[model samples]
Target: MGIISMIIIGLIAGAIARLLVPGKENFGWIGTILLGIVGGYVGGTLGSMVFAPHKFTVQPPVNHAFLGAIVGAVILLVIYKFVRARV
Candidate 1:
């Protein structure tokens, strides 16, 4: 169940993340997929950490997996940008 959910969220989050970010991204399809999954975990962890006591029914909202993915993607994107700039 968790694995399936992660995949779904990864796809959605990766799409949303790409939209949120400005400019062009050079990652291919596979890279994007990986980014999304990682992003979801990142977003979920951060969300949970910061709002530990806020209990909002679903709390973590499984649907928000995409958000997590986006967070992960964004971080990766930033890192890529920074490294690219240095190179």
Candidate 2:
């Protein structure tokens, strides 16, 4: 997928992730969107590392991409909360 496609997917994935996780975040919608984009990158990278050899990539089908994004977002959210709590 292209940058634009990734952004769109990230937006949706980010929104879904935000809804899935219950808690007050430090950022707003734009932050969520950016988080999603970063999540997409992180997820894609990790997924590639874990599943690339097995060829279980999340590129072709949209579902995998969405799933990956959610996973990534959740991870980021957790980290964010952890760090925020420390500050």
RMSD of 1: 2.9
Q: Please write out the lDDT profile of model 2 over residues 1-87, one tens digit for every residue.
A: 888887788888788878887888767777878989888777877898888554655556556667888889878888888898899
Which numbered prediction scores highest in lDDT against the true structure? 2
Report RMSD (Å) for each prediction in the order shown: 2.9, 3.1
TM-scores of the candidates in the order shown: 0.69, 0.78
- Please list the residue runs of candidate 2 whose C-alpha ends up more than 4 Å from where it truly belongs after superposition: 53-62
Predicted candidate 1 versus true structure: per-residue lDDT over 1-87, tens digit per residue: 577766766766676777777767777676677778877677778877876545476566354545556877787677777888799
lDDT over C-alpha atoms for residue 47 of model 1: 77
The CA lDDT at 61 in model 2 is 52
